[model samples]
Target: MTFSDDLIKLKQNRSAQEPLPSGIAPYTCSAFFKSREYGMKPKARRWDHLLSKESHNLKPSPLKTASRASGQKKLISLGTARPAPEYFPWESLSLRCLQDTVTEQAQPAPTVSMASVKLEQPYDLGVAMNYGFSGGSPQALRFVTEHIEIIHKPPYDDWECSLTCGTTSAIEIAFRIFCNPGDTILTENYPYSGAMTCAHAQSLHILGIEMDDLGLHPDDLDHKLRTWDYTKGPKPSVLYMVPTGQNPTSTTQNLIRRKQIYAIAERHDLYILEDDPYYFLQLGKSKQALASAQLDRTDANEEFFKCLSPSYLSLDVSGRVLRMDTTSKILAPGLRCGWVTGSSQVIQKLVSYYEIGVLCPSGPSQVMLYKLLDETWGHDGLFNWLRSLSLQYRCRRDNLLESCERFLPSDFCEWNIPAEGMFLWIKVNISGYRQTHTASHGDGNVARYLAVEDRIYQKAHDNGVLVSKGSWFIADVQTLKGVNFRLTFAAAPVGELDEALQRFARALETEVR
Candidate 1:
């Protein structure tokens, strides 16, 4: 049959079949399932000019191309060397998961399983355990795609999703795609340490933009971009940030701030790498409000989504935002599974990178996630779980906040109540320490401040408390001015939070005295 004839027949078959229930699509890549019913939103503006020299040199893998051809109906694949599924040791896998709803009493967790014999199922171990496409197994990709649509629906058309190993890997891949060695990149003054290390390894220059409690300062970002210095390197074309509950700082950008930053990106023609792992941990404006509010299971999902700060992807009209999300924080970190959403062209490039690099995310992880998210907890169930999870985190945050209030000396330390995420950023009054322990040389003032920070950190450790020094997270050492520390309320038991803070307070008291 001619290609047009095949297309017509396929359309006829689709029309003849019963339609899927609302919001449900057949197992396929998100690109194939994107809704076009919104009356022709404009396609993402072309970003080919932003590609790095290395990305431009990447070509499609010959083996992957051949594998695509092998998918044709009734085609015999004598050329490929893939092992048969029978050789796989595993027959079936089962997982025990807590019920989506919170309960006053303990109950037996539900079990979900996937078996090789379940060929009739949309996804099973047989297909998932073997070699697969670089983007990911269709089942997992579909789930993330649908989740993204329901949550942050990008404003532009032709956006796509691709499964990733995790956000860390995604960051590295992004850097490779858009930046060359020695290229400058912009990020918050206090950025995630891991990301800083990743950029450093690539020999990329990082310019730290000043920030406040609301997160990255839009004025600082715009001023830095406006006053570009080519002698340092090509003007940065990328901005990396953690918009929601930013790491080390625990600052969540409000809607107005997000809009201002997006405007700056548009003005400067820069791509935004929104690394938002803490996006779902939004705890609201006040702890008391979160504590008092009762969750209505019927409308909890709607309420939860409404409370969230809009993502940069939602504001993206030109598809310059590449948002990375991971299952690490929301789920288990060891799963090492996540996904990136961006323009179709950008996603295609990431997929190509996957084919030549990791090949694909772990098959077992993808299949297990598929069974958990797609089979066990449907979209509503997952949202219900997320709501419950947020409440649990809020309780933990409250415990830590209460502890801080009771233990930390008001005269020496202060902090802003974190609106989201697992951390509390505390600013220490270091004026006394600096005055008493002045640097021998005038130029050593910053060095002297760092020494005092180290002294305080050591005192805290000796007093049996652990806290992260803010200096370790500084994107630019030259920007370091004050003494700060990060403390996490996510891992400790509620009862112990107070004791930990008390120890930290005692240590601070001794050091300042």
Candidate 2:
């Protein structure tokens, strides 16, 4: 305890410790910026060593600026933030182009527009060939923004919209914007595997919340956040879920449940990445004809329309929710056009991301889409298209369910009839099968379950029927409470649905036994 003894102990510790590498020097009190003599310019000697042997003759790329004596200036922008002139309000240009395309059959067509700002048919074609230049066109942005406001009705000032290549890019942008590596994100019991890939690829930790037939369980979500084991990591700051026509499950969250989940996110200061591509494909009531028995058909439709579950974006007041929508469902998947609506802060980042990623949707696709939806179909026409699509899907869903009932035995399988979306999610539990809930599904015997699921898939394929294994859509199949499979009523021919079900039944019998 004496001063001499303490000095001796410190000397002994310093002698026992390892020394730094041969060439490395310790950083003590170094001045990064210090004024030297002669005009107090940067200290030349300190940075002179960094100048390459290229002899300091390297000059930056020269901008093609007109001579200073010239009256007109030709300033060109080569920055990444170049103005997206192609995205300007081009419906008027599109209509003119369409009309001219027909009118100028005999006239010599000018492949290039002589004018700088005004675009013609040739311009449209050129843009289509290489669209998404400098980001989305202005008109494309307008249509995306207008659709969400008139359709979904997010708060005007609190939210903004941007056109993305598709839902995948939109989600990837959101992940990068909202989450950092090692951050926790709350996901549903069964998440869209694509979104899960984006999350895990970013090295984010995912916590799966319990879900019911109606989708994410708010009570369980609240409990998970409130009594979180921080020792695992930090509290989840983002919630990734699908409110309508949940993937693989084909379930939609009712309005009350959506409200509950929103409240929990608010309480936990969580940002919601609401991915709802099936919002327009709601199917239940369309199965039973409009109640035209009592009310007029129009009135009956209004009632059914009102019955569709409200969106989580409708309940988010904190501007914490960002929604991803795609035309892939209602329109065409190859168009690669989708949009996100959320707080300005995140949307701005997403736009920047798009500029670096795919730039924007194809120019022709955006223009043609805007013309088709806004100029030709209009909102009313879109609604009509959706109704027709829904009716078709509903019939397919009903037929598949009936076929399943007739084909698969109850003891081996069960599924709730989904009121919304394209697929029928059937729980495939062979009789006497009771799975034990052990560790996190990630560490469980997922490989074994995957092998089992793959056998069923291979069998179904061999029988000329294709079913998506539920494991593909879930975070971890081993911890799944039940064996499940997703059969799409959307893609198969209507007459073939029943036959497909028969084939699925055969495959299940072979594997489940």
Candidate 3:
């Protein structure tokens, strides 16, 4: 049997030995089932000095602290105002989930259910409806932990995982924990706009490092850190990136590039916030063919695992990487479920924030995920589903690329084929417009460029094709130097994608001319 089979077996053995007596299992970490037999790995170095002033002052919620005692065996006397499971209105829950396969034809999805009966299901409405610990319910936590271990096995011994409401919430918690007001943070030239706003709300300064086709340039990052001026407050201690299928740019960092960036982070003592929502959506060159080949093999799960790009977490020997993962891309976004994997100390700090804030992810979401991820689809099943999903997205990406080639004017627009993720970044050549329009208008080059971008965006909107302005994703709007638009292939039908591109092409022609 393969390594994945061994892991599933380990999980099953553990589950059999520790059945939930009263529907609630004790809060646990990855370490519970994580094999320590692997040759001696160094422990993660302490990061106390890197924490924010706010994080330093944060105290655990008293009620949350006391809730832990309720998990003890045969200890029934509860001091906290805990609700009886009998009072929860939900008697049972069920889900109709797709079968784990990569065939071309549609297959019948199976129904998986969880009832209040502990014997019927290990996780059910009883534990799900209750106010649980900030770390999340043990069943869901274990599945994610094992998932992380099987996939990106962090090199350090102290790595742990905790559930989050979603990647957006995880970003907020991470920023709060690591950044202070007036502190500087480094990010890719173009980042997820929501993250920039999150940082700005806390009065943090963001510096955008130059990037190439492969993603953030390591030399640019090193140069920025080495030349950081103290007059602008402290040097940036955190470096945020989307690493795989990077937002707006749709660039995936190769292993060599990732190692180069990690070395720079090590040299600068920087903490890397890896917000990789599109990690699983990594569609390699000719992904549909690759998926077919893998599914044909008996070791499809192991082969699929081998094909994935290595995560920053896998390279984090010092535990400087806080990797945030989400179900928003792989699963339905409405689930509002995600997870963070980092050093134990960092994870504990995040849990403290959760206790005072959201308390925990929606218990219903957690239980549903537990049922789906842990009960219905095990680790192997999830890998199969992801492989199938990646193929579907790849086909969508192909449709968009084909549309761009067939409709868009070559002289005015150029785009790199996205290797992964949902977006296609188009670079509009506005030099002709700049020469003809900006020179005549007497407006500064930046203003003229932005004006052109606005006109193109409005034209596209009027033509019934909505595209994201590239300028909106820039970390520093003052430094915007290009007229680019981000188009997504994730939404819209195959036929509509072509129509949308045709409309966008017309808009570009009308505006740029």
Candidate 4:
């Protein structure tokens, strides 16, 4: 079929029940920076005006004096250091404070000395005291490789890994190295907001393929490539996908889907950017224990594990696939440490981005994480910790699900129970609520007026809950429907989840009442 023919058929085959887009107007230009499209209406888009007003609150401080003040002989202008805000934890506590706390807490007075920059005795403490390899300390990479071997295997011993600041920096580097400006990248219609934003900033053409529960519909993917207008422009240079615990949507692509998607990428010679931050966050019971030692060198071997599925990195034969793994969710977000494993070419490119961009992520953060992992948890221990975490999050997900089911109006809110990841993407039926309204106001009923006003994000925030609005993810602002929002169960404590849900329900009730 022709490209146009395929596009028509795909649109027709989309779930007929899908609601029409209802949020703001289509974006006039890319919002790598803000735009005026949402500001056309004076009152309808007052939020846009408020945002503008807030942007001007910061002024750049004058540059610091190059030379020291001479003997107070009329000390000239040296930029004043503002007293650090209470919120600034870094200013309040120094590294020395942490050392003192550690020292005081030790029962036997810990042998490790906090006084010196370098430790003289035992256990190669130098790694902790010193800077590591550019790609990260060798031990971190080895541990990651070992983890990958146990989980998602690299193919043919051909793949290599590099440490990135985080997935964001890795993706930015990937975009820069593999594809040029105006290159086309295939992604889900509602892709990761960060990826979409990055691609936009780089002037890459994002070809958003429609997604289903499984992920990018394989048929749609094939159709796009097979039916593209090569005559008019270039074929897609890269295909970006978040197969496991996708952001915003929280959908996990099954192996059946991966094989098909991989096939399409291979057929089209398209680079596959498998940007999965929550790869290890798969929310299900632990799988049958296959000895970690028994696993092959490549993480590729465990691709089809029944309970916890492996990644696209495992399925890749050609070096086209670039897999991003992060410690943010599993460890702590503050660490800002993650790794990218792919072809040597890809790793080299990302290394260059690291060299020029931030040089490397925090040296101490890496050291601390590395030491914590090596000392406390070896490979097996780390795996077990992740499994325990997965279990905890699973319980959290169940709680969030239960809360929504109990509190939300049955037909009013629609969402998919995510198999893996934190978010539950929900859509509210604004029009349905409009049909029934008793007029309390002189002019019109409150419910009728409220139906026209979307509360996907605002209502929740006002009620002491917050979620990412769907409009933030959609590229075409005109196509955005304000009805949807991505709610997370990750941050909130389990005890508070029900209360948060109650707040969310009350927020919605205000409109109906």
**Best model number under TM-score:** 3
User: What tens digits encode model 4's per-residue C-alpha lDDT throughout 95-162?
Assistant: 21111111124233223222221233221333333333346555455456545554664553445677
If the candidates were sorted by their lDDT against the true structure, best first, what order would they fall in? 3, 1, 2, 4
Query: Tens-digit lDDT track for model 1 on 466-503?
Result: 99999999998777898899999988777889899999
TM-score of 2: 0.73
Question: Stretches of candidate 3 above 4 Å error?
Answer: 1-25, 70-72, 102-105, 117-122, 286-296, 434-443
Any idea how many clashes model 2 has? 5
lDDT of 3 by residue, 1-513 (tens): 465666766666566555433445345566665664433788888998999999999988776665564545566645667677777777888777767764578575778777875325555677777777788788888788878877887888888899999999999999999999999899999999989989999999899999999999999999999998899999899999999899999999999999999999999999999999988775667534454555546676676677789899999989999999999998889989999999989999999999899888988898778777777877777888887788778888988989999999999899888888899999998888745444345346677778888888999999999999999999887788889999999989877998999999999998896
Best by lDDT: 3
Residue 84's lDDT within candidate 1 is 72
Please report, as a residue range, the 10-residue window in candidate 4 with the lowest summed lDDT: 22-31
Model 2 worst lDDT run, 10 consecutive residues: 21-30
Inter-residue clash pairs, candidate 3:
none
**CA deviation > 4 Å runs, candidate 2:** 1-123, 126-135, 285-304, 433-452
Per-model lDDT: 0.82, 0.63, 0.84, 0.60
**Candidate 3, TM-score vs. the true structure?**
0.94
* Sequence-dependent TM-score of model 4: 0.69
Candidate 3, residue 434: lDDT: 41
Report lDDT (Cα) of residue 64, candidate 2.
14
CA RMSD of each candidate after superposition: 5.9, 19.9, 2.5, 18.0
